[model samples]
Target: MNIQTTLKLCSVAALAVALSACVRVSTDSGDNAAAQADAAAETLQDAAAGAEPADAFLARLARHCGQAFEGRIIANEPRSPEPHAFEGKTLVMHVRGCDDPTRELRVPFHVGDNHSRTWILTRTDSGLRLKHDHRLEDGSDDPTTMYGGDTATAGTAQRQEFPVDQASIDTFNARDGLSVSVTNVWAMEIDPGQRFLYELSRPQDDLNPQGRLFQVEFDLTRPVDLPPTPWGY
Candidate 1:
């Protein structure tokens, strides 16, 4: 072969090698980018799985904001001798006062024409808090108002238990005939689109030999008309 021809062949060979290297580098970069994207997605999934249960519970309950549900007493064990106040009364729950639902939610519980009770759920630094807000028809706070407790454990998203806190125990002690409530343990459960439950229980003791068990279930499938604004809003 001629010298110029040989030189041209060598140039072509080097050019081909350089082009192949460029192609390989481009493919490797694309593969690396895809791997990083996959890793990022997996990290996000793991984070969601490890989220706090109390936070998940709050998020689930917030879905019912601005809605009302009808409820009935499902169980009242060791039944009262006389007709209980909840007997033959219409029960309704209005999920309202949700300016920032994740932070706080107020649920008004209406019985017949009475609008004196509200259940306040709040997300605190540690976990969730449940407070009973009782008021009179005149919009005045009841002597037994603001009595409830806080979640002591990392309950599930569907259920949470609130054992009577020291504050609530103090309130019960101050009130006459309310000493039996010192052992109260309140619980709430939700099955999204199905049912919601509010429960109260107390262990057997001298004051309450039979203890206490009361539960009310609300149907979430069918929301009722909004009830009147609760007393003391």
Candidate 2:
């Protein structure tokens, strides 16, 4: 989805569901060289778990086993604001088990470039979280990733744990910056049949003298899916 570049370019903001901060994100020189190692170990673990064993990306897509749904990017800015490169996209989501109280893949997203990172999401009454199914080219433990989003500042996000909430599902949408006068997210859906929508909006007080803000929606669909995880682990 190229969102890795988008996320890398702009920081994620708290949806006001929680008082969060920035997540410090980093990577090592031996990127793909290590991915393969992690995959092998994970593959073996999957076989032991009795969960479906999937590789490449078909396996990941299998997890999403429900009807197609739409996703809209609601803007955190004025109504007539500029166009977001990744705005207005619908994703067919296969929320395997949102009915589960403790965990749910109600929402999932493609991490960086297509086939790179796969994220599973879970939501609770108080807040939400996620699991980062990370791996290297050779199935090895990847460099420990630390992500902390910004609560209300610049270049200051919480470390990528959530270590508190790390290893959970909502890591992909975690924030590392404050919601500015303009706030919004570039929403994308993995399901191929869904339609693109946008929930554009701006904060009440931040409105201009006209007592209004600029927000808009458009369509840009590129059907995509998650990469397979050998195990649900």
Global lDDT of each candidate? 0.87, 0.33
Residue 74 lDDT, candidate 2, scale 0-100:
45
Q: lDDT for model 1, please.
A: 0.87
Number of clashes in every candidate structure? Answer: 0, 69
Error of 2 at 180 (Å): 1.8
Model 2 regions more than 4 Å off: 1-65, 72-77, 88-90, 97-102, 109-202, 206-233
**What tens digits encode model 2's per-residue C-alpha lDDT throughout 93-203?**
323443552444433332222222334543333233334444454555334332221112110011111222322214323433322322322112221122223222233
How well is each residue in 109-186 modelled by candidate 1, as lDDT tens digits? Answer: 999998999999999888899999999988999999898999999887778999999999999999999999999999
Q: Pick by lDDT: which candidate is best?
A: 1
